[model samples]
Target: MQLTEAHAETGMTLLEGPVFDEDGKLLVVDVTAPEGEPKVMRVDVRRKTSQTVHTDGRGAYTSAQFSPYDGRLYLTDFAHGEIVSLPPDGGDLRTFFSGEVGGAPMNPDDLAFDEDGNLYVSDSRGLTEGEDIGRVVRIDRAGKEATVLADGLAATNGISFDADHRGLWISELTRNRISHLLLGAEGKTASRHTAVQVDGGLARTDSIAVDADGNLYQGLHGRPAMAVYDKYGERLATVEVPARQAEGLESATNVAITPGGTRAYMTVSGPAGGYVYTFDALAEGIRQSNGG
Candidate 1:
């Protein structure tokens, strides 16, 4: 497939999360510099322009998702170890979950909400390698409590619900694999098994997004391609990104598809800056808002 440069060299320190809001605008997080403040950017795909929507002068933001239950935007604040929210129109950010919950530090990397409005967070522990301390926590809709669904993961990063809302897919970065957790009646994890093992140059998987047809799109950290997989852990295709376009980037951090799945967006991160690339997906993205 031919990939087009939707926006490039935008001076973003590091771009991670990418999600389409209800208005059809793509919302992404600018991680800024290492230990630098983070900002949320709204991208106009047609115009190929990006504008800052929310900026936190203190912490780094990683992922952003729009919740259909409350019609608000929820974000993962990595630096501050918190989950925050704000109106879709943009306003003062409010803390949804903070400090430590479920006997673990907050260090959330990415998050996804379940069908019942419960938020699931991947607590990465900020460790890059050889650490089995990562965890997956579930936060109630009221944002008052948390429950650890799974632990002892190697850098839990990406997370999303399957198209049927019966399985929760999570990416274990250091382990180089994705796991599918079966959900019980009350949104609790009943069991989990490795869904896919990423190998070769694209071993390190970061974030994941699903299409309406139950195909999974994974952002490869060490490669320039997005790995595609079927619902039953079968590799279907790999979308190769042009090297010249991702010039200085070291990894593709996140992938997001539009509501209609006609177009897809990806974020590549590097020291110089981050780049957001768009391509024709022509597939309907799974409705994450409805926990699909």
Candidate 2:
């Protein structure tokens, strides 16, 4: 298959945290660069109209999603290291989780919830001074203790569980690999394995989510695109930008596949590339062609 590029719908900035709502609308975190306020933007899947749901006094939103159970909109504040929760109908912003782990200075990059309503956060903490002991934290529904499921990771970024709730997948950014952990049957050890390694030299994967067929779609930073991989870590296919304007790399920082698996949306953060791109999934074609 040949590379194809679709221009962003226009007038978007520093887009990140792309997610799909149950109604099939596309929601993205819009963060203006270097000191811009953060806001949650919603795109009407039917009308294709984009509007802001909420704006932050702090810089752009890190990540966000519409809670299926409560219908509240939750977002991460990268600049302040706080989880901002807004009511379903939109109201005063409140801090959901501020330093859930002992007030450790860190930022919440991505998160996922399970069928049982357990929330998991992909925290990217200190990485420069070797303090990059990121974690997969599990927070109870009552907003109580945030238990560390696992630690000592390399920039833990995005997370999602399998459909059956027996497995979890995490994006280890610094290591440039996805780690799969089998959930314990009865508080047992979470068996872990390398799901897939980033090819083409550390694409610097940002956020990842699973498709209906159990395939994983990862954002390939520094190379404006999404890399598709099977459950067994086989490269299925790559969807990339059509035009490479300059030598400087374009980074696709976040990704979300719609519930139905027909559309895949990714966020780009390059100077000329901070808009979301949409793609139609061809799982059968990708798997059959093998990296086509």
Q: What C-alpha lDDT values do all the predictions have?
A: 0.75, 0.65
For residues 165-230, what per-residue lDDT tens digits would candidate 1 score against the true structure? 887899988888999989897778899999898873534888888778888888788766778888
Report residue 94 deviation for candidate 1 (angstroms). 0.5
Task: Identify the runs in model 2 with alpha carbons over 4 angstroms from their true place.
Answer: 1-13, 33-38, 100-103, 128-130, 185-189, 244-249, 283-292
Model 1 spans with C-alpha error above 4 angstroms: 1-12, 33-38, 126-129, 200-203, 289-292
Candidate 1: residue 4 lDDT (0-100): 22
The count of backbone overlaps in candidate 1 is: 0
Best candidate, lDDT = 1
How many residue pairs clash per model?
Answer: 0, 3
Please provide, for model 2 over 136-185, each residue's C-alpha lDDT reduced to its tens digit, 9 standing for 90 to 100.
77766556767777778888876776545577788877888899878785
Candidate 2 matches the true fold with a TM-score of 0.83
